[model samples]
Target: MQATLTVSELLKRKNFEHCEVVAGKEGLERRIKWIHIVEVPKVEHLLKGEELILSTGVGWKENEEAFSSLLQQLITRNVAGLCIEIGSYTKSIPSSIINLANKHKFPLILFHQEVPFVEITQDVHTFMINAHYEILARLETYSRELQELLLATHDLSDLLSHFHQYLQETVVLRLKESTTHIFPPFQQNNSKQWSIIHKSIIDDTYTESKKISKKIQVLGKEYGELYVVVKNRRFTEENMLALDRTALAISQHFLRNLYIEEKKKRCENEWLREWIRGEVSLPNIFHKLGKIDGLHNYEGGGVFLCRKQEGVMWEGASFSYAKLLLTTLFEQCGFLLCITEYRQNILFVFVNKRQKQTWRDRFTQSLERFKKSEAYEKHAKLFSFISVGSFVDRLDEMEKSYKTAQITADICSEQVSSSETLFFHDDLHIYRILSLISDQRALHEVIFEYLNPILQYDKTYNGKLFDTLKTYLACSGSKKETAEHLFVVRQTLYHRLAKLEQLLGEDFMEPRKRMALEFMILAYEQIFIKKKEEKFPQCSEIEG
Candidate 1:
């Protein structure tokens, strides 16, 4: 069917004695596309390198400079190796030429046997053409498979399972595995694979394969790699080339599927979030989701809001597919959750905690598992953090909990931005203070009332003291920091604090009152901005 040609295979041909392979570096091989043969030196003008260029030396006279010119020209053209036919006229491959080839590390060949040059030309070209054909055929097949994958209505897991079956091959998606599951096959070989196959690939090219190592592409982007380890390790240059093309096709398919899945999730996420916004009752939320199988007997429950920073958290996972992914990640105790709101944000559905003795512990444990799952890490950066607020078990608690989730998630998102992320609500002291500002009306009242004296002071005297207090509170009440930030001396800052205490008839350093006042100021900073937006929606400066 198809011919296989390797560096070692090509060398085994008879009549090609004294044929030496030089410059077999990975750097050299990548630049080569295919080998070629032409009798005319004029062929050099039309040549692209990495080709095996041949000549009979019929037109050349016996000048040393002329011999070296052809050699130099071949090097400049970047031909992989040169095959020169030696005859009575040439009189045993020139010693000077031999020295030059050795010096340049150019592969030089001399044919002493009575072998037809046409035979070598025909065999090599025929093999390459066949390889091109086989590669193209496989690509066509994979292209069709990609089309089917996009058209299918199944979720990510089903699509992947079906894809593997269609190809009659195993496919693996290697995420950064946790201690729980073994890193599956096709994850990645150790670093040795990089050094071993590098010799065959020319550039940071799209895709290529040598033996089991295949670089797979998806929509011209290399998202993953594939390996097809068979019984034979005898992969040649041509063998690898064909497989490279195949890998490109398959990888393209996967990338396309991933894109489509993301788009579908976005549409579904919008619908789901809209559904969550309107959710008042536990069963009502599930009914709107059209996934209410487990909600019949389920009591009220808690809600968690998880947002991905920029893109979908689970690259290929969807809300509909959460059934399978969450099943593994969580205890499958939750049902009908959706990724709603901004980037890959997730909202959960669980049996509402009816018992006062057990308040949100199991739900929190399940959330802890979800945060540490393979899916979350895959798309962690898209959202700065996925936060769980106080779970609301009652209908009235849902509204406050929803707002608390938004606040806690914002704080959680900002905390573990780079190295590590936290899921459990461990820092209760800070979170509790922040949670106090979750009520919209109460938050609004605190902001306006605390700032009332300051706002009045600013309006009456154009005083910088009130603004300084506001800025300091906004910056989380750091003193040396506040004075430097406000362009005031530390003593001036103390004087202003004294004025504020006298004006309000309250102690500025009292632990209880200061904590309340500080939270009120923080609430003002948080919610006042929203009110300003609602007040001036069309103002470009205020909109963001």
Candidate 2:
């Protein structure tokens, strides 16, 4: 039912049969909420909006400016229209007043015969009251039906269908992960047009189409958006109320699903923790997996660990959002993922659903896309490092992959400053070897025996010998390349090289010695340099 009473409709009443619109014909569609009879010159404070005002010209009959001011104020207050009695207080309507109303598209009505103000107010108020009551009753019925639908279905798409049916308009639900669900699906050829509309709405730049949107939230955080396109008519107050209720219902659905998923994840996390710790035997693992729905036929898999940056907290809604985003991204890339939280880090176990070995390329591509996404840009500060383990052939060997990924994360945490956030186990060639060595004393001795001379010389003289040698080795002993890299002239580089040879030995460039120097350089930078920077941050900053 239409909840609004427009000026055009009110003009058709028997009480207004002698009334004629003198100006602002374009505003006939203005909605009237109530009727007021005002004889005072100042009626601004008495009006809220959408009220059809009745007045006699007696208040400003002698002053045309005061009457014009009154009409201007009424227009500013957005009154539905003004009706002036033409018989008693004034014989004719002023041409200036007619022009003013026309200029602002404000409806102006003149009654040739006087009508009872009390009777008009009673008739209009009673009609509006009944309309409002009917609207409320309809809303109550809608709320009841919505509750029934919620209890009967677990799918959000089904809920969207119900919304579409009730509103009889196009509906769109867009989630945070860029997933869109649309009702009254468009034709295949119009899909592109819909995509454009969706993007415009998300960007908040759309103006060509009339639509209303509300945020759908979960746990007090915005999870998605609900949009309704206004087709051929304006939305009444009842329509807005209905949209609000729908948004709330969708939020409740999201909360319920999250609660159920979280409960299941807790159970899975415990089993995964034990399994990754190598406490479960292969036979028992197979038996437990066989009981699950889809884990019985897994071919191969790998593990990855995500560690938050220091001082960044991950709990509650933020953690849930991240988990859902990761799950959606990985599943779209053709991997079935199992996620758990352990030791303040997020762990993911992903298995290839296909028999082919193409998961690596797909995983890499997905990570690249995720890094470029808006979600990552907003939450980048929360993440510090991502360490990917080697792909294993069987589920039993997953423990080894998890351990390697953990080791990679540990290595990255202790290294000198680096902008890279993603690390691969296979790429940790020398770091893996260093991690395997149990004797820290021997490792320190190896670093000291190879690079101590240059390090001590640089510290004693405040020289650039250490940097020069490192760059020279990285340049493969190419003097020109080293000079260019250091932004130094050839003479300066030669002098530094001569000094470097003097500090160590002339035979330092031999194959065996060069290899040792290279390895020790990396180890010293990863271990000792980072510690020195931490101890004397000011000195490190000055040196850089």
Candidate 3:
């Protein structure tokens, strides 16, 4: 609180009982900073603002116009009040001067009993100084209490509870766009009251309950708000400062705790990567996992490799969103795990505690619900390719499971007509083996060898022989159907087939050779075509 003495309070002091308010009764609440005694006609130089001017009518005995002008001057200077001692120099104040005081709401006091000015100033100044000291002492005690609380506990709820007790007022701490945590958590009966206050805070309005709120911000980010509800209570300037300091303490605590959480997440990410990479030995993997919170238990779970749909329009926020979404789903779906982002995919290593089928169904439902959620509506076209690895009880076998999951996800990405997004590693074992073989240069060479001559001929002659061969294979070696599909005459189709037989051997259409050609064409379309499109342009010629 700021130190001050109101006009009414000043008049209630000892030896000032004879003072009477002549005009401007409405200004009784006006605070008096100092007292001034002026007797001269020109009193501007002797007066300061918020001073109670004391005088004996000396220079203006019968000049009401000059008295009114003096009153107007005092009003302009923002003088607290005017106290005139009567019967010595002047008998009474004029009605015109009283009317001027009334109009301005300036306090006009009359000392009916001629008091000693020196004694009055001494008494009032001493009282004001003593009151100011008391306020400072109270402020110091309150501040020290808050500082001790800050040192005693890191829990924000406990700090807020103590603050409420100290102030004897309700204290609410709200993280912006988050739930409100109250000191004495709102009672069932107080729901309406809480709703009103919440609306007021969100709408940037005020309620009947006097409140002093400050934004809890640090490093240019506003974390939340700290507001004290001063219902039926008086809050002072000192209390406002106390609230500010307390909010600052909470902000620092949140920031410090946030750093620890980030460090923990980074460590978890690294450990999981190393586990999947087989860098950690079977015996040491569990020990390393013990270093991370909530992951110290025995190993028995499956791995999930999640990849977003190709060409999905999403920003970096999608990564965090996916992590948060999956983490929430895992926890609620009863398969607790840690999530890590590798490249563009998010991996989750679930700690197997229940039936695998049940967990799978739960995870699928959670993902479906997430896709339909408002939070994910902006990414409406976004879908995920999640592949689950086989359950393994041993830490050493986890890496093998993780590899299977990764391969399965890649196979799923290449699928064009799969109705389901979630794939099991066991169900796609053939494709997994095929994907491995598809990565070999020898296999690509064999596939490209059979198709390269036809490609070159088509490019050189601008002919449709490759299309004719593809269509003939697609029709399962029916020449009439191939001719009808190619919109060519039967004789022309026979002539093209003879030319093909001349280029390739007569045994090229054998079952084994045809099977190899079909496999080669599928490999060429899936592997080589995609690579050609993605490869950077070679510097074969200099640019102008």
Candidate 4:
């Protein structure tokens, strides 16, 4: 708050025909820190000497030059204002002065009531102090209300309503972030939503954007995004920040709640998994747990591994959102499967008479697309990897199938992108280990040896012979096929194959070596891998 001068009040009470406000605050406090005074009415005569001046209109009474000169002098004078005393000489204020004041946003005041100049000066000086006090009070009150909202509620909608009620702006949130717009199912193909909303944001075509429009950004590492905008017709920057704080606060609480719920659900799910597969026969298959469709039908299934990134999902997305997203993912994957949460992970089992290779491929593709779509984020954020178990024939072996899918998915996670589909045994060793090992630790140790051999080879030789061996094995011991696949001439391929065989001291065609090699790959995934995985892990056959 600066020095204030109320012309009407000052004139009515006392006389301070002192300095007139020519272009600044009238009844407002003025902080004209360094000021001056001038009475000249000529452009050349008056110079840039910051101050306020008192005038009687003698120099610019009627002529146009006089009128223009007086106005120009004020501008040139660089004074705060032209406080004019109206009495015998100057009867009424000039129209040009009024016009100029309004044009330049120059503060000006006319004194109609006769009063001494000295007394008016004293009143302006006093009013400035009170104005400063009032401003401080408003700021403090605003801060308190904002703080209250942060601690009060968990529900964003309710919190927003509270803001609308108390905060006074017509606050509303834009759920589908401008960056990512997910239209209702049927209307997605409709481009109208883009023109009406999306394009506007991209171009900042928010020409119609109100004086204050606030936005909350929702981004993705791979998939579609979701933004929540809280709009108000009368919104101001201050009020918008308050709303942003409230929205952010509520979102955080919701996420924290969900994080806890997800853990519990995963725990419950694993218990159910153990029981369903008969790994832990705490009770009968039907014990307390309700039957899930296709539950009994799955003789064998796969596990999908995923990670929902921090702050990527809805602010309020709790375990409920996680569960819902999983169900939707599998559903869209074309499986009528049962899903369970297992500690920071979501697992799904797909069971139907041996699903067609093509259908499995398609299902995996759909999941990949969905993960990359607006429905979920990608790369542990929303969309993740999936590993399917090899088909099993006996119901008694269901537990084996479950563990295989889980471990295979984990192995697949290290080698492929979360956007990948199925993890076949050939691609990831964990699948083989999950297939072979009855005990987890033995599986881990064997894998450690296999990976270590390759690790030492890579670190020591800067060589790629191990990869060559893996590829040859993948081709099923056919020299021609392996050579063709590796894109080397037959003789060159033969030399490399011979060198590999010599190093390992075995024939590439021997069943024993092939089996050991395959099992080792599986063992490596289950035991040696650093991070374990959930059920569904994107295991795309494509490299990139």
Alpha carbon deviation, residue 339, candidate 1 (Å): 5.5
| Ten residues in sequence with the least summed lDDT for candidate 1 | 175-184
Q: What TM-score would each prediction reach against the true structure?
A: 0.41, 0.55, 0.44, 0.35
| lDDT (Cα, tens digit) per residue for candidate 3, span 1-544 | 3556788888898767888898999998787888777876777766678888878877666678778778878888888898888877768878878888899899998888878988988887887788778877876786677667767777778778867776777788888779687766767688787776676456555656667798887433577899887665556656786787778778767655654454577667877888787788866866665664346555377688767557876455454454445555555666666777676766778775456557667766767767765546666554445688877777667787788788777666675355676688777744555666876766655755677666766678866777888789989999889999999999888877776777666777899988777777666655655466653122231121
In candidate 2, stretches whose alpha carbon ends up further than 4 angstroms from where it belongs are 1-255, 283-295, 308-310, 372-378, 438-446, 484-489, 510-512, 530-544
Which candidate wins on TM-score? 2
* Residue-level lDDT for 275 in candidate 3: 78
lDDT of 1 by residue, 1-544 (tens): 3344444456666546566443333322223345665644445587776677666676464655677777777878877677666674455556787777767667776665456767877777777688778766765675566557645643344444544454343333322221111112233565554433443333334243332456554322344554432222343444454445445555545555555554555666544554446445555555643452434433454456656444344444343234334532333444334344544455653444245345456555655665565554554454235455555545434545555667667655543445544354445565456555556454555555556676667668776666676666656678888888888888988888777777666565466766777666555544444345553112233224
Count residue pairs with overlapping backbones in model 1: 14
Which regions of candidate 4 are displaced past 4 Å?
1-211, 215-237, 256-302, 305-544
Which of the predicted structures, 3 or 4, would earn the higher TM-score when compared with the native? 3
Worst 10 residues of 3 by lDDT: 535-544
Question: Model 1: residues >4 Å from true position, as ranges?
Answer: 1-303, 306-346, 349-387, 390-455, 473-480, 487-520, 523-544
* Higher-scoring candidate on TM-score, 2 or 3: 2
When 1 and 4 are scored with lDDT, the better candidate is 1
Residue 404 of model 2, lDDT score: 88
Query: What's the CA RMSD of model 2 in angstroms?
Result: 11.3
Candidate 4 TM-score versus the reference: 0.35
The per-residue C-alpha lDDT of model 2 at residue 436 equals 74
Per-model CA lDDT versus the true structure: 0.53, 0.80, 0.72, 0.51
